[model samples]
Target chain A: MITITLFEMKKIIKSIFFFVMLAFLCVFLIGYYVFVHHQTVPVEKLIVETESMIHMQEQQIQELKRTINNSEDGGNSQLQLDLTVSEQLLSKNQILLKAYQEEDWQAVLQQEIESNEPEVERMKAGNEYYTSTFPTLFTLESRLEYNKWLLSHNITPVLPIDFYSWYTVYDLDFGDPIAEEYIKKQSEKYSSTGVYFLHHTLNLLFTIFGALIFLFLFGDILTKEGLGKNGPIHFLHTQPLSRLKIFIGKLLAVLFLSLFVIVFISGFCLLIGSLFDGFGYFYYPVLIYGEDFSFTFQKMSTVIFQSGVLFIFVLLFSYALLFLFSILTKRTLTAVGLTIVVLYIGIQWGKDTILSSFSPYIPFHYFSITDIVTNTFAASVKNFAFSMSTGCIVLSISTIALLFLSYFLFHLQNKLLH
Target chain B: MIIHIQNVKKRYKKEWVLKGINIKVEQPNIIALVGPNGSGKTTLLNCMTNLLSFHEGTVELVGKKHTDPSLFKEVSFLQDNRILYGNLTGYDHLKFICNVQHLSTARITDVAERVGMSSYLKKRVRNYSLGMKQHLLLAMAIINQPKLLLLDEPLNGLDPTSAITMRNILLELYNEGTTILLSSHNLDEIDRLTNTVYFMKDGAILKESLLDLNMRRYTVSVTDGKKAKKILEEKQIDFTSINENQISFDETTIDLQTFIDYMNQNDIQIYDIDKQKIGAERRYQELFEGAK
Candidate 1:
């Protein structure tokens, strides 16, 4: 079995398609870095711009105060309301600028929490506060309340300026407290290094491009042998080894190839990160979600390690599914097409539906390793919680089941070609 | 017994390709499976090697059932050219077989030389001609020196020289106590290689031995063809004339010695006598003539 597995691995390594796909992946990684750098405003530049806006608002507030003093019966009620809102906005901007200057996000969050609580209470007592006067401010107050919830749990806020940039510039929302905590932890750990950038970049890449890469890598593993002109399955089937062993050998070969490509791509990305930016510390914090939808912080190393293991499990499940389909269909294109269709549907429509209800149980739930590790799936989709250990166990069991079924069906089959 | 196939029946869809094939080989020797196209010759060989499923039979090699994983350790099936890996070199295939069979590297070299594939063993199979692929198949079959060798159309794409070489290699393997079950349409090669022939029709074994039929015929070329004809007529012997110089008669119908004596008594001079060997070709014709 080992010999056969080694031979199969050699075949995959020497194949031209494998190398071509790997090359394309590397190129895409580089292009993604370039696009991100072009789109994102540098932290220092954004801070400077925000300070200028704060200064201008302060001048307008002073001028309004002078006009009210000079007016006959003070300013009208509307002018008074505008003055109050502007003063509040100026204070919030001053806190953000101070946080940026000192690089102390926790202090800024504490001050903001202290400042917002009294206002929240005062607004809640006012009749027209939410419906007529300032509905959007109420929404902002709720987010502040969420930040207060994080602080009470001993978690620091990601700086408000960084949060604002992510929301406005990148159009990303950390609306969920759990998501906010994760972004905050990641932001602190990565600190604008290439590793930090790549860490975030890979999270997006895994969600979007993972299925396509898996399809290109393992789509035809079994069917190629059956459908080609040479029909090598005929030779393989006649060997003394059991069909189960043969299937396992091929499965291991696919895994070995996948790991090789992953490791190669990761190494290349790391090299580029080190040259362009610097490698981040291994002790950075990562936030995880529990089965009860509770959030917790874990070390970056542990999260990364768990993510890698879960990634392998997910890939095993996928390859096993493809292998079973390949044998059943006995045609490369049909098997590949079916696999792609199933994956696309699962990724697109599976969340927050009947499938998501079985979170940490169904293999489809574990397809996105990033979501599993970061607990995003649990937060976004109700009744679902992301657990790495559970995902790994579920995926492992399904992979084994799929492999057994594949072997059983393959052994009972007598014909190699149609 | 080296190979025992009992009550084997195979079907494709609703049609029976192998009705009930029962063959037992008590000795290690070359056995030919002769049949026309779609006569289930290939099917029988595949079933015996456990490459195809038989619905109602048991196939055993060296006293072990066909499903036994260890059976292939001592058995090798030489399939058609379609089974060879075209992207891999011929040596890669041979080495793979050797690895699975637990044979030494030296054995691969030896088999390559024996099958006359040493010159192009390093080339990929896609670059090979049909004849070269046939040679590689033969080499793979004998790499392990298996006790039972099953060959399906082993000589399909070989030239005359290569065919002769293949014949000699099979003979050598047989000499070394290997039992070979070969299926082929090349009757002359079959006739040259083995006397034990299994003629199949409609998915069943018809005759095990062609020599046992005892239907040999002889044609004689004589100087006095009219006198010989008159003598044959007087003796109530059946014979057919081949022009004015020759006459043909079944050896079984009239003894050769009696015909020669009658010719001598009637002053007839016999120039030459030839026996019309009823090999596989004639047996096939006689068996399938009515069915066709």
Candidate 2:
């Protein structure tokens, strides 16, 4: 079995097609990295957005002043309080804009906390809640904590520590559109080689092309043995090994080969990231959302590790699907095609259906690795059960079930029964 | 018994490809399976090696069922080049086989040297010629020094020199106490290799031993061949066969020495005596004569 498996791996590694696909992946990654870098919004763009936001606030302040002047109550009316908060917010943005313009890292962190702390405290005190379109108290508080941590460590910020603009809530609605745009810009660079940026890079790659890449790599694992017929499979079959051993050898080959490709991609990403940008903070704060707008914070390292585990499971599950298809179809392209189509349809259909009550039991619902680790997928599907632990279990069970199904089918066609 | 295949039946869809093939090899010798196209020669070999599913009966090799993988420890099948991985070097293939058969790595170099493919052993099979592939396949088959060797068309793409090398290897293996059952269309080479023949036609086999049948056929061409025939007949030397102006027979009818003496005494000037072994081709034509 060891010999067979090693030979199988050698076959895949030696294939010209495999090498070509790998080269293509490298080119694609480089192209994507360059494209993303160009897409990162510059500081000047954020400054303009901030200035326009200040103007909008000024207009709102003028309207509030008029309402305060026309109020029947004395200056102690609700309009007076609204006027005060708006004026304060306007003055704070002016200070933040100046700090940002000067590139004064300390003042920027100080201004962010000074500006957002009052509103957050107000929400905590059961006063008028912070604007519904802004970050939740939990997110703002997490941001404050990340800022405090950075300030204490004397680390200059490469990307904003804003939890509202964190990986999970990257597109969260903000009261000021300019603020939303600014946060999106900060989060767009969340793809560094830093331990903090690992999940983003992984999510970016795996969520989009992980399955397809893996499928293309090993989609013909079984069929390339000439569909287990008169092809080179007979070479192994005529050996001293049993059919079960042959199947196992190929199965293990898929597993090991998948690992090899995954490691290669990761190493490539690491090399690219390390070369361009210094490794970022190891314990960078990553905000994880919970059901009902509740949330918590996990270290970026933990999130990345969890994503790594879940993504591995997802890849193995994909191999199992391809394995079964390769056996059933007995053709490389057909097997790859059917596996992709099946996975696509299964995930699409599973989202609104199984993602609810059956999310923990169904693996397809957990295809979004970053979302699963961050609970954003669960929050989106309204199923809090789509966590990393559940994904591991679900994917393992599904993969094992697929293995059994394929093995049973193989047994039926084996010469033993005949 | 080295190889025991009993009543093995295999069918493809609605047609039976192998109809109750029963072959037992008790002694170490090279056996040739000769048949026309689609006669189930390869299929029968597959059944005996358990490479294909046989619907009925059993196959045993080296005291174990053919289905047992360990049986290959003492058994090897030299199949078509389709079984060769194009991307792997010939050395890689040989080493892999040795590993599986629990043989040492030393066998690869040894076998490569013996098979005379040592020079190109490191080259990928994809770049190998047809004869080179046959060399590699033959090397892989014998790397384990298998007790029973099954070869299907081992000489399909070999030049004369390569074919001779293969025949010599097969003969050497047979002499070394390895039982060989091979199927091929090369009748002259088969005649040179072994006398045991299993003629397969329409999924059944007619096993024949050339030693039992008259292997040698001598054609005597002489001046006045008609008189020679008459004189030989009158001399009570029974003729195995008599053609126009030529007398051809085997030793079964009478001794060659006595017949030559009588012909010489009759003053018949013998011009030529063309000797030939009744190999597979002649027997194959006779077996499948007047039938497509």
Best by TM-score: 2
Off by over 4 Å in 1: A39-44, A47-194, A227-230, A291-294, A344-360, A381-386, A415-418, B212-217, B221-272, B276-292
For model 1 chain A, where is the 10-residue window of minimal lDDT?
A162-171
What is the overall TM-score of model 2 with all chains considered together? 0.84
Chain B TM-score of all predictions, in order? 0.81, 0.81
How well does each candidate superpose onto the true structure, as a TM-score? 0.77, 0.84
| lDDT of prediction 2 | 0.78
Every model's DockQ, to 2 decimals?
Answer: 0.35, 0.60
Each candidate's number of clashing pairs is 0, 1
Local lDDT at B173 for model 2: 92
Top-DockQ structure, candidate number: 2
Distance from true location, Cα of A243 in model 2, Å: 2.1
* Candidate 1 local lDDT, B1-292, one digit each (tens): 7888898998888789898988898889788888878999888877776667778988888888888767888888898788876667888888887777677878878988999999999998889999999999998888888899999989988999999999999998999999999998898888788877888888988853445333667889999898888888888888888879799887766978888888888778899999867666666676776411
Candidate 1 residue lDDT tens string, A174-194: 567676665544343223345
User: Model 1 misses residue B268 by how many Å?
Assistant: 9.5
